[model samples]
Target: MLPLCSCAVIQSHPTVSMLVTHGPVRCGEVRRAVTTTSSPGDKSRQRLRSVRAGAALTMLTPLCTLVYVATTWSAGNRPAMAMICVSMLVLAAVALAGAQAIERAGRRATVQMAGLVVNIAGFTALALLDGGLKSAVGAYLPFLVIMLAVGMPLRPFLAVAGLAVAGYWTVAIIGGPAQMSYAVIHTIHTGIIATLCLRYSAAMVSLQRRLSDLSRIDPLTGCLNRRGFEERLANELAEAERTGDSAVLLLVDLDGFKEINDRYGHQAGDDLLVWTGRTIDEQLRTHDAVGRVGGDEFAAVLSGIEPDGVPVVLERLHAALDGVASAGIGYACYPAEATSPEALKEIADRRVYRDKVDHNRQVPAEAAVAGARGDGARRQSAKVSRHERRRRAITETGRLGISTPGMGLLYVLLFAGGHPNRWLMATLLTVAVTLGVTTVAAAARLSRSSAAAMIMPIVGALQFTICTVVVCLDGGASSTPALGMLTTLPLIALISPRAVLLPFAASAFVAIAVFVGVSSTWYAIGHLTSALVVSLVCASRGRVAAEQRRKLRELSRVDALTQCLNRRGFMERSTAELAHAHRHRRDLSLLILDLDRFKEVNDSEGHAAGDELLCWVGATLRERLHPHDVVGRLGGDEFVVLLSSHSAGETDDVAGDLEAALAERIGVSVGAGVLGRHGTDLEGLYAHADAELYRRKLARGRGRSRRPAAPADGNALVA
Candidate 1:
């Protein structure tokens, strides 16, 4: 009933869980089992403990045999009973001592065999003394088999088997027909043990092989992983040090992997990586080892190579990699390039990085060349687009009625005429005229009404300067004096009511100085005085006009909210860019961005949030864009960008980058349109880009937007 109860309880729960629930009692049992199994000590201490345990067990075993012998002797067949008793005791003691020695000696092959020899000797003696087969010699066979199998190698197992067979034959012969049954039983037992030992040995070998394979191979690249490489490298370095041979280490990197992933799909990039790995493997020598150390990075170790040969090996690798698209190779050698395996790897890795940098530097030039060969029409269209952009800028500026300060300097020169400092006068005149003409032209295009007013004063100033210069150059009673007085008189009067007296005073001082230097009469002095007065008055007036013009231009060109260049400023510069592109037959691209659903912000979050969004977008764009790219807000939620020196494809790339950059923030759709090689002029490009932008917005709404489309002719439109 107790056994039945125990079985039921045990069946209800796992043995381990039950044991844990039993707490200290079960824990004590487990602890006792562990202590019996192995102990921490010097070999002798552990051996002593094992010896004691074995001796006690052996003693008990023989005593039990004596009881069996006594029962047999009690049946009245006691002739050798006493001798058997003495023999059993002696054999038990001997077995105990032998086990102790085996444990103490740590079971070296020689020592274990010696112990086996002692056990065999004891058993053989017992069999011979007990009349061989007449005794239960087969009973001792199991003990011998266990000892030999547990403590010794295959040699001992074979020896035990041989000895067991020999002992069986000896018993059969010595005891004649009386011990035949015992011999048969002993033979059967020995055979079973040998078969089990052989099976266990095979299992161990199979498991060891499986572990070795798992530890060494990398599943991804089917090469060594970092762990395997480190192990292999250590072994190689040790071998090289011992053999006085050198090996080369190489580090290879894939260049433009990130760009490829961004432009193409990651799946394509992965295909590229696999292709690169195979190419590297094919290029390496059979003796060389390669491993993928990191993403887009690989390393190789080459043996049987001298330090000097390292460079040659690297060159070969480089050439091999060059054939593989977007691959770069770098290498270092042992015993020359570096003294240690780690150092060599470090040097190789650094070289690989430098190679990648050099490879990256060549990309732009390569793209430009490709663009030139592939898309001549797009290139022409890009130029026309740039020209239109410039014209738009000029028109915007004209509407603002603004002039830059640089223009005012021109007026100063025109009014100065042929004073002794005539070159200064000419320089100022040129600056003013250039500024005024450019500003007026831009204004006229943007706003005819404002442009007309701005143009009049500029034209009048130009005509006045021309007349003044001609009169002075002709040595006639110079209209310069009168023109100078006309320009300066107003400024002085405005600043001070008595400012009219300043010209008279300035003339008097100049005349007095001239008289001192040249002994001039009153008539000559008066002529000189008038010229001096006129020059001073004109200089003051020119300065005042220049200041006013500069302020106006700044207000026109700069965006009031963001303080960035306004649409007008961008157009002006874009026009000049177009002209340059047309002249050089280069490509230019335009990007138009209309923030999708921007009105939603104003409607839901209020106008303040909408304003914040605009400011944030503007700041973000400024930060993310390249310094050379032109950025402008084209009123409301619309913005425009002009990219120079880029092919239609390249422009698409830039636009994609901008879209991705913006996507990270506000939930807005960005659209890009490109025109080049006469496909569309600047205005047409903008319209096309805007249409594409709307298409993108529609696509986004339908969840159809994936990667923005590259332009049909390698020009791109993105939303």
Candidate 2:
């Protein structure tokens, strides 16, 4: 089993291919070629360190051997002692040089082989000079033999182990009064341990491969990640340049995927993304590369394919996607379009921009479209999903705000007085602890939504106030229990912030002043100090946590460049608004828009201008729309707007206004879909709006194609 497993691993990894073709001890190119935690350069540096350490160890071994010999040197050991001295001096010298030599691949293998020779000599000396396996010195022999396996490759490590076995059996048979059975049993035992050591080396190699995969491959779709994709693309480009063939790059932005997430939820979106990856892979040959470049966006490189071949591949991909996703393909052929990869890449990108702009100008401006969600951009926000809410809360703080009622428990115990007061205190603590647990349990239901943040804080503050009353009724502010109520305020602040905390704390302090009288003023010092200290601590923590939460939320929901809601956030907000409209049977409309000639601007002026344009678009829409309007970037150049309480006519009016406004700054096309006329929900409205946008783009293109007969009247008159 061990040999078979070792053979399997060796055959699978080309990095270790030298083991079969070359001698068993030769070094192979196992750097970045094998998947590992460290890069090829890092691994080379590590080998240098390992060689240095081995040199130090090699020197130490002779010193240890000298000590053992001095303590128990019999007359039979003189020759073996001489052999040990010679081998030790030679080993140490080689080890020192090995450190520098190991940086080079072939020399490193040779150094490891030299170290193995030292190990064999040391073990052989012990096995011959000592009283076989029964002697203490002989027992040390097996350990030294296996120790060389650590940095060595499998074949080399096993070779060293085999040498140890032969030396051990020879010593056992000759020096242990010819005990054959004992030699066999002990040799077998040593073999087992060596086998385990060999397996460890293989396991280490396997672990490295897994880590490399994690870095290079997308976890969701199993496609090359952005960095990996770029690398593969560069390779393909080089190949195409050398072979006199062409390559095509397609940048596919899934149409209306955000709506699918809003309607069916995130799991459905995730399934779609995974399915899309598989579908894209199926359309390409093995050499072609596809990657999930960004949210709702996929980029593909088909090498050695002509310009005509590009459409057939895209058509097959469309068939594979069916109606679930509509791909917008933009490709530039190699040599035909541009010779250099970077130039061709820009051309392809501009083509994608052209595609989006063309589609926008052709589509009518009065339709709402439904978008299907991919798995990557499918999950709803915390408000829409219970599991998502809890996950965010727990991941952010690592607990369910457990300290909300921590000080309340101390108040319950201190205020144990008369039956009525005891009953009151117990009731408050019970409610406090229960609410504390409930708050955590309800994290799944809580989010940035204002109502959710207040639930636990309100409940906690009320419980604390009720307990304060109980303490004051017993003995006023002078009572320890009453003072503990001040401590509880800060605890509430820890879970909440100034919003619910300060108001509740102020009211409780006022109640103390009313009940305890002017005499309790001096006693207020302890309460004030406690409140000040605790409140400061809790407030500091609260602010830090809030900032972290804010950043995390933005990362998840906001577009990095545009600072607008991403597909998921927009879809969730729009989905909720659409549902509300449906319940009330009120009119609602959605507007989808794309910037015209956005690519030309990017291609001519550079990406910075394109980015600035997108940011300006986001800011402008926000400024123009009503407060309740939802705006989001649906990746690339597409944008969507959800107008709450707006009828179809109102939606069209707003969209036209937006188009007119942007007309001065940028080329803009708009499409509007009403809830009642288009499909009622996010999906229907999105689909209809998208369809309208496409129709308008087509109409514009045809109008441009038809040139008027301008010269007929003037030229005819002149003639």
Candidate 3:
């Protein structure tokens, strides 16, 4: 029974713990805690300048050893000389490796301290191993002073000094004992030097901390600046990657900051910024960090938090910022929301702007009321004054008995040739009839009406009959005269242009026909020549006017920045296309594209880069699009495209292609929306497309991945 009880106890109590007294905690938990601590440390860690100094010292130590070797060789004792040479080589190698380590590992101040120790210890060992100290101690003193000057903390400085002193004593004791007087003097000198060096080192550390603070902190808000925030965030991410711990970063931006600056002045705006920064800082945990990454923009790094906790953190931030006199807040979290710094910032900025827009919408209502009141008052005042001025002008005109010029000229022409020749009368009547017919025919042709097309031949026949009548009236001379009249009619009609040209052409043709029929051979020839000259003059004038009108139309349709079709052109063309598609039951698609974060570019790099970016985007679209696809530049970095034959899937594919292309070139996200056959006409299509575009833009603002519109076909209509 005793043996069985002992066996049971031995089996039940495992001896693993007995072997090691204390067991280790889980490696995962230890890593998690380290990661959490290290995240905050990265954000608030002070940069030590002493590391650079250590590197410099390490490099100089090797050269100093060489100098010591030369001096010792001059003082020559053969056996000790070989030891000195060997010691110098060994110390130099150690110094080189220490220098390399310090230079490579910047934030490892502990490692740098260890390197200094090695360097100092190696010099001490060399001193004891060789008899070169009498000459080498002085040479080494400069290096020790340099190490102290660079920013080694007091402990490291003192340690180095102790090593130097010990090494000197070891050399003295080994070479043969020194006198008491010399030892006492040496000790006093060493103490003074060490004290001064330590004091200097302390001064450097303070200076370095101050400079680091200056570089990293925002002067206006006491938050880390953008550079500091980025540096800290990157380190945090790296640590999270290594430790498998989740961390979140939030980009916070204050909305309507510019409006505050504009309305209340920049001083109030600056104060508001300071208030926001302080408020955000207070709301964050001690383990978190906040930074002012831009004007009116701040960022926070939350360590050791679940990704899902981001929304709660954002809510807390929002609650803290809400109802703060005149501020709006937007925040985006990392890992849970976005994997990249830029993506997070973009999401935050978009939300901020959305809030800003909402705020602005409310503000404008009050302004609108004020504006309406002012407008009403101004309108009443202007109405009375305008009526009075009109009355005065009418009275003055009545007193002067003034009449517009040109009525007399019109009457003179109307009655000029009373009892006009029968041939001429016939010519005039024929011209009128011919012009009416041609005018109707041209209108029908432009309308593209089948009924009009059927009437065109009849109208053309009527014109010919009128000319024939005029020719018969004038006999053989009428042809020349008829041609003259035909030419003159079109020219005179040009005064009213579109409306009058056909009638004028008819009249000129009839006149020339009558002249050619009635006149003698010589008269007919003269009439033809005169008519030819008149027709040439009229043709030239009409062409010039048409050219001018075309130029005006072109100007109206084009955007100045991108040279793409303007909004008016888009609306007009879209309306026409919709009407046609509705009538024909043909398929049509509309796509709208908007550039992301365009305003930021405008803000940071000035409007010039923004303009350049827009132009580049337009050029890229043009190059990528098929000839038939119509691309138009809408206002403010917005563009629209029309695809005549594409299905929704094809359109989506094109959008994605375009988005990828644009992303490569400008680093701007392009959002696209498509309108399918469901769009009854151009307007409906455009509205649907625009809605989709807006939805895509909103999704992008929410930090979602989006594809661009399909590449346009070469044959697609471009505005």
Candidate 4:
């Protein structure tokens, strides 16, 4: 008798205690259940993907079993095996139907739960008919648990694991005296699989949270970026429509921003921009939303506001920005002005343009900046160099490669338990050990030397060559070692640089061809086809991950509002640039520009306008300077620039130009220092620049501007 004799059908419930949670698979709902950093949408998508993969494989497993049983039937256990064979077919049919249900409407939890029940029952029946705990089919129970661990939440998966262990023991007892050794070994294996699955799920959930933050939040203003803002606006509009309440949309454009940026340098412009964003955000209700939608424009949404009360809010908004930048304010009331988001935005934009035209006659002459170059153009090169990226990609493959020998040793140990291949196992183990040591040494060399990045292709070729040899010695594509090729070949394709991939893939396929003689030709062909598909998929994912890493790296280094180097980015880049300058004995100078009366602007117009001004200032500096020059905001109202290879006279001339550019809207005090002439190191030179800045400020009678200068401490260049 099987565990099915219990008569207690595991009823599914939508709670933690249930054997399985049955409901319509809500995409992001489960992701939200846990406090994950990732957005609900991202987690939902990942969950659905796992479910689909698991469901597809689960459907195929029973069908594959049925085919195997049909092809190999024994006469001695005809009736029992025949009954189990019928059960396999029935389980396969149920799985097929369940898989279809999951596919039609994303994941159907009930269907998944039903499929798990069928699998456990079928595997148990097979174990009883074969040899219970001694049956090879019983070993497959852990694999089923692995699938569950990936596709389902932890609690339910634990329940399923418990169910599998119970079934295994029940079948063993029914078959006859239970083998304690077999029971212990099988349970340990199941437990290990469960532990690994739990760890993998936890890690994935963490990564998803980080990726979510990167995707949605605006780095600069500590407010919603455009994407996040739009999402919120849409939801607010939907709520307003549902509740029959009014929504107000306001669009504000900074006036004379270009003049301010052109005059003050980008640092001051960025300061103004940061201030503007902060101020507007402060003036708005906690529930009201604001976002920097464009270069010199911001938009805000006020939900559930009465039309009559809008004037009061408008008064506060106008008072907030008075004298900040002569901002052009335009607003539209939802359900009154326009129903849709796009329409409301259009109406608001047109009104703002009209308001700007009315406020200043020069509005007709002012043109919007075209094709504003992003912060990437300001840097000479990427933070991570091309060679370093290549090294990193190869290093991942080497890390995975280093583990192959241990896997091989494990295989050999398992084979020795049953097979008569002492010499063969010893030789294979020796080879695996030798290759593993070589791989570890090579990986170490690769990490230490950038030039070693190119040698990875050769190492990859060597790895595949080993796999091919192992397949031949182990008895072909059907052998355990042959499975290694399927896993290893795709990894090689994924991590190898494009220049090496074509040849590596070709050679890998050739190696696959050799499997035909040692193993079944059909198995060889299947191996080849499966390797190709898996390789392509893994390679694509690798490229995407690489891109994501690069983008995230850039986001970390750049200041959110100004798109200039934040203090950390500046110090890191400047130190490297400074080192290069010293190595080449090239001229270098550091300039620190502090905006005059910047805090007063923050107090008057609002932080949002001040932020807008600062944004413009950062843009001006980026636009006016060469790409090789480094611009960074070292905390409030102070911008630093490192001019590599610039002589003192040339640096002075550049400073003059900056002063002239910013003299119109706001005054800027420039302090200069040159390497060797002022001081040897960055700190010494920074000190020299600070003294000059103080002298200039005193001359202007400003009395050492409100914020004190950053100290020239020995760690000035430290990131």
Q: In lDDT terms, which candidate is top?
A: 4
lDDT of each model, Cα atoms only?
0.47, 0.54, 0.46, 0.57
Better of 2 and 3 by TM-score: 2
Across 1-719, the per-residue lDDT of candidate 3 in tens digits comes to: 00000000111111111111010111111100111223444423322223333343344444544444554465444345455435544543454445445445653545545554555555555545444333333223323432242233455556666765675566556656532222333444334433433443243233323333333444445565554566567666666677777777666555544344334323344455556666676677755667765555677777788866667877777777664423344555556677676676666656655655565322112243233223221100001111222222122212111110111112223433353455464445545444553453344233444464344335444544554454444344332223223222222322222332354444544454455444233233333333333333333433444454344345445554576665555666666666666677655577767666665675565434666788888888878887666778754556787765565568777887888888874544343334444445454555455446545655656222222332222111222
What's the candidate order when arranged by decreasing TM-score?
4, 2, 3, 1
lDDT of 1 by residue, 1-719 (tens): 00000000111111111111100011001110101111134435644554545444434434543554565564333445445546645754664567666565665334334434444554555456545533433235433443233223565467666875676577567767645543553354335433443433333233322223222333223454444455556556766776888877777766554344334423344445445555566676654566655445667777778767767666766676563345556678777778787678667756665666576422222343233223211100001121332233343222211222222233335433545645654554455445546655554353334454455445434544443343343233322222222222222222222344355534533433343332223223333433333334333433443344344344445554554555456667777777677788777787777666664454355334666777787787778777777777644466778877567778767777777777765655555555564345566566556556656766677222223653333112111
lDDT of 2: 0.54
Task: Output the lDDT of residue 85, model 3.
Answer: 39
CA lDDT, candidate 2, residue 51: 66
**When superposed on Cα atoms, how far off is each prediction in RMSD?**
48.8, 21.3, 40.7, 11.7
Report the lDDT tens digits of candidate 4 across residue range 443-514.
Answer: 545665756655655666666566556655655555555444444444454454243464565455456556
Report the C-alpha lDDT of model 2 over 158-206, residue by residue, as the tens digit.
6766776777777777876544543553454344434443443344344
Worst 10 residues of 3 by lDDT: 1-10
**Against the hidden reference, what TM-scores do the models get?**
0.35, 0.42, 0.38, 0.55
lDDT of 2 at 653: 81
